[model samples]
Target: METALTLQRTRSLRWRWLWLTPPVLFAALIAGTAIGETSISMDTVLKVLANQLLGADYAVDRIDAGIIWNYRLSRAIVAASCGAGLALAGVVLQALLRNPLADPYLMGISAGASTGAVGVTVAGIGAGAFSLSAGAFAGAGLAFGLVVLLAQAAGGGSCNGRSAQASGAIILAGIAGSQLFNALTAFIIARSASAEQARSIMFWLLGNLSGVRWDDVVLAVPVSLAGLLVCLWHRRALDVFTFGADSAASMGIAVRPVRGILIACVALVTAVMVSMVGAIGFVGLVIPHAMRFIVGSRHTRLVPASALAGAVFLIGSDILSRILVPGQVLPIGVITSLIGAPTFALIMIRGMRAR
Candidate 1:
């Protein structure tokens, strides 16, 4: 009877988390919108959102309203979307590959994006026609394509059996692809970019949200939702993947097709994010591992927990970037690394101790 009561109580708490998460996420978004260079109050933030979103008449200051609605709100939304997408991608990759260290960038999408952006900016490949985002997206696709081909050539596609071999092949292929694209980016930067161009490219490569707008919000939110839906749809498969691919196949999972679809989804989501905001690392890598600690290993619980945690983490990181230094906004990536690196180390230590 006591055991039954404990189990029921535990389930009740889990359900409470589900009920509480959305409100917490909303509050985090509001907090992100309110805290910035000018320190707009939460009351004003809510008034601005109500005025714009619900067409309510709130006599907020014009400048504050413009800053809230036009700049900070949109930025917050995109940050949330990117964070959720990247975290979801990480969860998928880690599950599929059965590697705790696996992340969205494991497929070389970020490297390809950097290469593409540099090719457009420094090599003049687009001749003033292509935007940096376009170039980055194209580069990401090209790089992922090459990585897929390399993985196939190295026997990653033979999912009739030998799932572990296929996973290893893909990881190796991704590493090679990343090295190649990163070299290409560096070469382009070295060969043609002047100091100013190099500085701009470097700044962008480190990640920037200074340029995000409603248009980006449109792209990010839909892609993030789509990615989350796709991952959640495959949550069962992902849970199975935690075992070896052979174990998943033995359980009647179509290991090859499922792997391909999920990986392609991850690549698409990562490419879109990299194009929009440059490569922000560690959110994907750290957030999933951290969520696993809190939510356990079930994909049903793990996936959304990771997404929410990731969104809030990035929003908080963006906030810190804005205010960490007087009169200067750091690259969001720098702030994440500063936080993620130490947190990751602690996680590793905990894992080692647990083992």
Candidate 2:
């Protein structure tokens, strides 16, 4: 009884803590604009942001409003959208696969994206008019379809037949898919028609947002919103599946159809993000796992917490990427793996000990 009371108190505290997320996210967004080669003041940044939002005639000095709105703001929005999408996809994948280590990349989505992105550059698929994102989406869609087919084949296309072995099989399939795609991507990268095009492919693979435009956000946001809605709508079903397929079935959750839809939703969102960010590795893995540790396995709280945590995590990473070098910026992807790898190792150590 005392243990139950302790759990309840902890739950209440987490609820209260979640209330701080929006303001925290807003503060981080504001701060993200403050740091750069120029280093604008917080007050100036806030005032400019406010003027734009409030349509006030007040002029802010020292900061380029055009630079802020056209350049920095789009980068920040892209970072946030990427974060939210990665975390949400992570949560859904973990639940569906019933494995803490499961992530969007685990299904070969990243590999497929890399393949498509590379293909466009090497083959000159669209020649002068081709978009990198189009290649990425095609690769991601192909990978998602393949993974679903492989998982279904392994499980007889039904949850009742999904075993612990299915998880391992799916993971192996993803590994194979990744290898095939990476090899193809590497081949294309090696034989690029022009050095400039090759350099673009290299930078895209490194996953930096040095050239983010408002158009990138325009493309990412709608797809992200649709994916976010799918995640939230299926939150309860995900939680039910956590108790195992038999238990979820007992609870009246339709497993196979739901799983298919969720996978497709996550893949679409992930594809959009990867296409924009060039495969921001480990956001999907780290953010959801961290939220699960703090908020427990319940999806009701897990989904939002993952989103908030991911936003904060990516925003922080982006700032580090900018400041890590005096005159040069590191790719945000490198920053995430640098931080995520150690954190994930620690989590695994503690989780193993607890077990």
Candidate 3:
């Protein structure tokens, strides 16, 4: 049944049409850059992009150039980077844990980041992007460490070797960690914040890219690129996990250490992204799963497809968020959830039918 489904999906996703992804991404970026409180046309967007990015001689107005280059350009880049990073993290976690439902946030990383960002937001500690980012990264690390510690206590880590038992332990640990940290976060909010601050925290937690700038884009680019390279490097190891840990070990892969490394990498990349984008959902959870159906189960194909598709998906969502309501920018996360939830349902329906 799985084989038949794979074949069917593969036939539908022609290799030639795959070239459309780049152009689609470019178009989405252009559209996202142009659509805002001050609407710029596609031509001006392109002209600004060319002058700034390619050192072209095309003329552009200063106001439009500032808006496009400083604000929207960075926002668009960060959106695409965050989307790709989140999707990569999701793919890694799903492959490592052998669970289709796995996503970057399942291990309480998002909750931890929420706690950290809230703490910063409410603490009056410079409430800047860097401060919130620092807090979130620290919190994510804490959550990740706790999950790993508990998994080890339950003898679930692949420290010695990989086993189904270990994966179950990690998942259980993650659940426990999530509940505990979530409660802690609520406690922090209740104890430390006024109603307004709490409300602001909630909004931020839902994910807002409004404050994103070129600084964010600069920060995200290296991490996203590094994470993608790491995933690509280990794609073969990920592919063999479908056959089980022992099978992978027989093929000369160190399943346990590799798992640890990949999980850590995914967790950090995810934490960094959530720090910038606030806990945007669905891109990570849905894009990889959908891309898998299109590209087949091979990690090599899956990773690149997920990266590009995820980038396009988030950039497109950012555009929708702007246009969804005039003058009032909706949180990008909300838009993604609206789109993702439906796609997720559709995927489930198709999966069930296949089964």
Q: Against the hidden reference, what TM-scores do the models get? A: 0.89, 0.91, 0.86
Candidates in order have lDDT scores of 0.85, 0.79, 0.81
Better of 1 and 2 by TM-score: 2
**What's the CA error at residue 114 for candidate 2, in Å?**
2.5
Pairs that clash in candidate 1: none
Candidate 2: residue 330 Cα off by (Å): 0.6
Model 2 spans > 4 angstroms off = 61-63, 126-134, 148-161
Model 1, global lDDT: 0.85
Which run of 10 residues does model 3 get worst, by summed lDDT?
A: 10-19
| Candidate 3 displacement at residue 90 in angstroms | 0.7
Q: State which candidate has the highest TM-score.
A: 2
Best by lDDT: 1
